[model samples]
Target: MRKILTLVIIATLTLGYSSLNAQNYKFGHINSQELLNAMPDKDSAEAKIKKYAESLQEQIEQLQVEFNKKYQDYLQKRNTFTDAIREMKEKELSDMQQRAQEYQQVAEQDYQRFQAETMKPVIDKADAAIKKVAKENGFTYIFDTSSGVLLYFSDKSIDITPLVKKELGIKE
Candidate 1:
């Protein structure tokens, strides 16, 4: 009976140890920013945004120049005008300023929408590639180290940036 109890205890310990070893997970880290910067689509998106912003800026500048000209004219003629005409001119200036402000706000919203639309596909592609790479390599979890969310990771965790880049057919 003593020998049988000892064997049972040994068997239980062995199974527990093996179970613990089997629970080991494969983890990896990557810099998402690096992946984004390396993508060709990102460059095109940036160029498109830049051009759109320049066009909006040009329109704003035109509005500003018109406002300045009108203000200057008002200043020059205010001394000679009747009180009623002066009030009318001031109202016109105020309306023009309000319109310009509204246009600026609209332009900003449009730019933001455009940027989000342009980046969605690129971001989706990158995410797919990352997921594929992680699965292919048997990684249980892949963390974005560049996002500043991870406080600590062991050296044993693999850096899977190159693998993801390769999976995406990216050169660098």
Candidate 2:
């Protein structure tokens, strides 16, 4: 009876120890903002937007310069010419100004729309890539480090931002 009791206690302690050690939970964190910014495709999209905006701005500036020159010429002639010619030149200048404003508005709207369209797909792809990384790495839960809301984290080695970024083809 004494030997059986000792054996039972030993077996119970061993089973408890193994069970405690088996409770290994893996978690990961991702700096989603950093990854998104570092993506080359996002850089390319941003560059395209900037290029378009710059081109539109340059065209607008050129138009303004031409309009200013023509207006100055008209002002000089107004002093020496009939009221009809002066009014006609003023109307032309007003119409050109209006058209320039309209052009800028249209360009801004187009750029915004394009950015939204381009970003939606990029964001979706990044999300899918993150999910794939999480599943493959056996992460039970993944948190976004960029949110600034997680106040408690027990382990830093589980921060998988770099790994996820690499898997998504983002470098540096």
* Per-model TM against the reference: 0.87, 0.67
Candidate with top TM-score is: 1
Writing each residue's lDDT as its tens digit, candidate 2 over 2-105 gives 99999999999999999886676677888888888878788887887788778878988998898899888887788886788778888899998898889888
Question: For residues 1-172, could you state the per-residue lDDT of candidate 1 as single tens digits?
Answer: 9999999999999999999976788999999999999988889989998999999999999999999999999999999999999999999999999999999999999999998998899999999999999998899999999899899999989999898888888997
Task: Write down the worst ten-residue block by lDDT for model 2.
Answer: 154-163
Q: Please give the lDDT score at residue 42 for candidate 2.
A: 86
Q: Which stretches of candidate 1 lie over 4 Å from their true place?
A: 1-22
RMSD of 2: 8.5
Worst 10 residues of 1 by lDDT: 20-29
Q: Which stretches of candidate 2 lie over 4 Å from their true place?
A: 1-28, 137-143, 147-158
Task: Tell me the number of clashing residue pairs for each predicted model.
Answer: 0, 0
What are the root-mean-square deviations of the candidates from the true structure over C-alphas?
A: 4.1, 8.5
